[model samples]
Target: MAIPTTNRAVVATASGPVDVLTDTELDVPTPGPLDLLVEVRAVSVNPVDVKLRGGALPGGDGPQVLGYDAAGVVLAVGDQVSAYAVGDEVYYAGSISRPGSNQQFQLVDEKVAGRKPASLDFAEAAALPLTTITAWETLFERWRLGADSTGTLLVMGAAGGVGSIMVQLARQLTGLTVIAAVGRPESREWVRELGAHHVVDRTDLLAEVTAIVPRGVDFVLSPFSAGMVETYTQVMALGGSVVAIDEPEGVDTLPLKWKSQGWHWEFMFSRVIHDPESTAHRELLDEVSRLVDAGTLRSTLGTRLSPIDAATLQEAHRLLESSATIGKVVLAAG
Candidate 1:
């Protein structure tokens, strides 16, 4: 299929509320060397999208296209592109430096994109990239956990998107004891279904976690770590590490010093944008594709919406902001 001259996009008029997101048309971008001009078929909403759209996070002037996760078919490839062809199906959590996947046609770097899993459709594949990359980098890259590594991995917000994949990956790939902590009792069973070794209450972090692991947890993937650093320090094992996907601002690392514990942040785009030659995102997604195809992991897509547009996107963003939905929310681009 040929690329359209003008492609549909939902652009934010300004960095404010959800109403800023409006339907618009954009010119199809020309592929550069090492670029894949993808025909975006599916997209997934994320908390970052909400943050950027709602002025919680600052972006460039005027309206901006907001998306991270996408599954699409390659319409064309740049002359220098080597790994993918015109018809190849690919998935990626695109670079924050570029225009996002909220458009019909978009260009993504070949090194950052991966082959979509054959067992999953575009929507399912779309749900994986952003959250998968975040979780994989947090567990494997940031924490430096290997296949042979064995310890207690505490997924602080285990029912959410990143934690969902992190729990499954830790269970399937590593020899670690995975403890999925949910804020509510209702989410306990959901986390168990994702193969968490233990489902504990995240609300009662200190008492509940201590009851289960008397020695304290070895690693923690915390979603909200701003004011809980002291409590987390108590729950962590000696020399253990904690990683947060969200802003860990206002957090004093002093408490961790006594225990020789560490607190780190994991943003998936950092490696791709800063280190241009990095192939970690693609490699992670490729391994994730193999895992999904082999029935080792499952798609975390929870609510599937339809016909990618401003209204659908606004709803998706709203849902993510509520923090009530479990797993991921994906929108079909048809």
Candidate 2:
């Protein structure tokens, strides 16, 4: 198949609102030495995509792409690429520094991309990469919790994209008891079905959680960071660790000092932005793919929108910003 010189993409012309995302045509991106040029099949909307669209983050002089998670087929590979070749199916959460996956074609580093799971389709596979990377890094890397570690893990905002996968990974891979905090009745069941050992309402978080485990949890994964530092400190065991993926206004670390507790932040793009030698995403995604194919892990895709375009992407962004979405919302290319 001949690769086209130009491709269709959803470009954020000027960051402000969802209207900033415009469907436009641009030249296909050329891969760097360690890059793979992929024909994007499906893409998922993430909070970072909305943040980039809302002018919270910096944008380039020209229109900027905003998607992070994608599944696609390799159209070409650069000189140094060896892990993948043309025609291989792959999925990845790409670098924040580069052009994103809200396009018909994308350029991603070979070290960050992984083989797509054969058991899932493009949209299903696309939904897993970013959330899986975030969950895996938060659990095993940032928290440094091993499979043999035993204790209760309290996950705040447990039905969202990253939390959904985090609950499953912690339950399936670790001996820690999973305690998920969600507000809605449906979300409670959702987290329970995903393998949470206990479900507590966020409205009465401290009491409900303490009722289940009087001693306090050993680990806390917080995706919604607003007003959570004090609550987490009160509910954590001595020497426990808290990993947050959201940016709160500010956290009072003074309270954590008394308990000798540690606080860590997990950003999936850190490896791609800060470290050139980071191949952990590749290894992580490969392992996730194997787990998915083996049925030990499952895709967290909750909604699907048709025919990747500006209008569909706008709807996806709206859905994500509403804070009511349970899992990932994916857009399938026509």
Candidate 3:
């Protein structure tokens, strides 16, 4: 395949809100020996995407493109790439190690790319990669909850991006009773529709979860990392585990130690960013793809924007930052 000259991208040179996310053109990147060059069809706006662009990497030199989830067709492949070829429709959460999918094209490792789910459109598929990867990795890889434990698992903030998928994965893939913690009345129906066995208001997380489990939840998945550690620890059964994407602020491990419990931190980017045991990430995403294709899973994109341009992307970012979004938000390239 021939290389393209330039691609449209949302570039961030400084930190702030949607205004910081600007449009620019840059030379399309060439794939490395083990990379797949993907012509991005759709990209999802995530909190991490906003954080990285808005504040996480403040004082950066040049434009830093920010997007994690993407579904696209392969335009080219590197010499060492064996899993994909040009024109393959694929989706995957590209590694946080490099520039993101806010651009028209991106180079990602073949190991991280999976054939796009047959059931979804580009916009919908774009929403699945990042949050799905996070939920799958956190539950299966980190919490190890695929067994017929018959115990209850609590998912906090069950109406949000990662939680939306986590609820379905738990109910659809595992024998564990699924309890979803949602604060809003409006979101309760969505959580239940997603297959949550029980839905509780987040304001009364402990009481609500205890009402279902009696003892405590056997596992807790905290997608909201917004200082809910103490609440989770209180409602988690003895020896039950808690998995989080980011650490809760000012949380102490003493409570967890007393219960002989465990806390696992899942940074989905670890594999692609650091390239640590890269093959495991490949294996997990492959399984995710299979599950999605089999109809056991669904994409989490709650809203879609068009054109994949600067203005549309900026709006997506603003919406994501509001923290009120029910599910994943995506930008589609026509």
Candidate 4:
């Protein structure tokens, strides 16, 4: 089938709250030779979108589309698109430099897109892409944890979107013990149910974590940084590493110097932006899809907003801004 030439989208006219978002028509983006045209069914919001929409970006402006994660059906393949065909259900967290998934039709590099899990709906599938990519890449690629390696992994902010999937992926895919750090009582149980071996409250983070891992954890991952590099440094075993998705809380690297500690930053959109070693992300998504299909990975959709409209998406953004959302928030098109 021929690809459409225009699309409906929610666009940000200027950086601010969700009120900046408006429904608009845009020229349908054409796929590059290596890209594919996706008929978007659902999209998930992340803090990164908030950052860009709020003018945190260096020089970003104009009517920016803010969604990163998406689940959709492939409508048309670019000339070089060899991995997928039209009508294939797919999911992806697109590049930060390009237009994102907040549109009815979007262009994405085929190399970074994965087949959606057959068992999940578009909303559930959308919830997995960005967080799953961040968690999976951070654990396996950055921290070097393997399926056969046995060690305890401390997950900070463990009830959030990425952490929810991180808990399940750690429990199901790796031999490592999963230590989930959550603040509230309900969040603790939530992580525990998702397969965390131990759940600690962030109110007294180091003490609670040490109580669970007397010898310290082998690795620590923070979904939202709150001086975690320094605070969690002591909770990691000697030679252990810390990885963060968000900016750290002004930590001094000196504390980690003696331990030869490694710090990593996971940005899932890097592949899509720079196109550096792009196929690696596609492979990662493939692996995540397999894990999901095998029931080893779970989507982290905590809230669902309908019809992918401006007002509903605004509410989703508001909920995320509250900083208490437990899991991924999704906007699904009817």
Candidate 5:
């Protein structure tokens, strides 16, 4: 297959709203020494994409491409790349510093990429990377929860992309009793199917959680709204740990001081941004791929949009910003 000089991409011109997301043709980027040039077959929308598109964060000087999760076939590789070859099927949450997978072809560092699960297709596989990396790092790395650790885990917002995978990883990979906090009846069932041992309504969070685990939960993974931090602090057991992935306006630490509870933030982009040489993302994705092929893990793709054009991406952004999305929305490139 010949590499084209120009390929289609979804570019954010100014970043004010979904309207800023534009479909355009751009020069295909050449890979660096440690990079893989992947022909992107599928990509998924994440909250960070919405944030970046909405101008919540600075958009730099020129049109910025904004996608993180992707599953594709490697079309080329740089001299220093070793883990992947031209034909390898790969999945990754790429670096925020570079142009993203919203383009038909993207250059990703080999250390941040992993073999795609043999059992899943591109769209399904694309939904796994960002959320899986977030969930895995939050559970084992940030909270330092071991596989043998036996305790109850309270997952706030347990039906969204990260929450869906977090519930599964905790239930399947650890001895933790998973208590998922969800607001809607449909979401409650969704989390239960994903291996949540118990479900509590977010509307009545503290009371519902207290009723189930009267003492308090041993660990808390809050991936949703930041307003629930206070409730989480109140419901956490002494020595319990809390890990959050959302950027809340402010979090007060006074409540956690007395109980000696710990709080940590898991940003999946940190490894790609700060430590590009680190292979932690690749290793974790490899594990996730194995689990997925073995049927221990499943993709959380909730919707699939076709063609990977501007309008479809805008719709995806709208759904994500609406805060009503369950699982993930993926776009497949033709």
Candidate 6:
């Protein structure tokens, strides 16, 4: 198949409402020295996509393509690319700095792309990469959980996409006890099925977690870091740390001082956009592919949409914004 001169894409300009999201055609981008021109087959909506669409997370003053998680086929590779070929299947959470995977064709660095899991199709594969990379980086890189790492890990947002995969990763890769924080009755059994050693209501995180651990949790992945800092300080063990995925601006470190505790942040795109030389993203994705193929990990896709257009994308943005979505919502790309 010959590559088209113009690429079909969904683009946003200022980002006020879902109506701002529109379908259009743009030039097919040329790959850089280490980039891959991927024909995106499927994409999943993320919280960041919603944020970016609402102008909460601002992008360049150009046509912003709001997507990150992608499962696609490689149509071409840059001169320096070695790990993948033209016809290979791949998946990745593309960099925040470039045009995103919502387009028909997008340029992603080879170091940020990995082979799609053999066990899953495009929509399922799309559901994993962003959340998988986020969970992997948070567990292994930030908190340094390993075979020798024996302690309690309390995941505050445990039923969501990242939390779902994080539970499985911690259970399979380390010796730590995973405490999944879920308020709804619907999610309790689900988290347990995903390998959570303990389940607690998020309404009273401190009381429920204390009853389970009794000695305080070693690490936590709390979403709203600023408001929960004081409560987290009380529930955390001495020298323990909290890894947050949201805004850290109002999070005062004063509470962590008494116990010698720490508060860290994990944004999966930090390395890809800022430190382009790191192969950690690709390596982690490949490792997770092995896990998925081996039946140790699973896709967290909750809903599926089709044909990747403006109205469908608007619906995706609305669903994610509601904050009640159990898992990831994916779309079949053109």
lDDT of all predictions, in order shown?
0.89, 0.90, 0.82, 0.84, 0.89, 0.88
List, residue by residue over 227-299, the lDDT tens digit for candidate 2. Answer: 7788888898888889999888867767888899989999888887888788888989999999999999999
lDDT of 1 by residue, 1-334 (tens): 7777998998988888888999999889999999999999999998888888877434666577889899999999999999999899999999887889999999999999999999999999999998998888887789888899999999988989999999999999899999988877777888899999988887787888898899899999988877888988899999989898888557788889999999898988788768999887788899999999999999999889999999999899889888788899999976
Q: Higher TM-score: candidate 4 or 5?
A: 5
RMSD of each: 1.3, 1.2, 1.8, 1.8, 1.3, 1.5
Order the candidate numbers by lDDT, best to worst: 2, 1, 5, 6, 4, 3
Candidate 2 overall lDDT versus native: 0.90
Off by over 4 Å in 1: 56-59
Error of 2 at 307 (Å): 1.2
Candidate 3 CA-lDDT value: 0.82
**Candidate 2 lDDT trough over 10 residues, lowest sum:** 55-64
| Better model by lDDT: candidate 3 vs candidate 6 | 6
Backbone clash numbers for all candidates listed: 0, 0, 0, 1, 0, 0
Q: Per-residue alpha-carbon lDDT of model 3 for 39-118, expressed as tens digits?
A: 99999888887777767763375568877788999998899988888888988888766888889989888888888877
Best by lDDT: 2
- Judged by lDDT relative to the true structure, which candidate is superior, 2 or 4? 2
For residues 33-77, write the lDDT of model 6, one tens digit per residue. 898999999999988888788875456554688899999999988
lDDT (tens digit, per residue) of candidate 4 on 196-309: 998887778789878877878888887766655677668888888888788755756677777777777888766566765468877887888887788877788888889887
Provide the lowest-lDDT 10-residue window in model 1. 54-63
Q: List the residue pairs that clash in candidate 3.
A: none
Tell how far residue 243 is off in model 5, in angstroms: 0.6
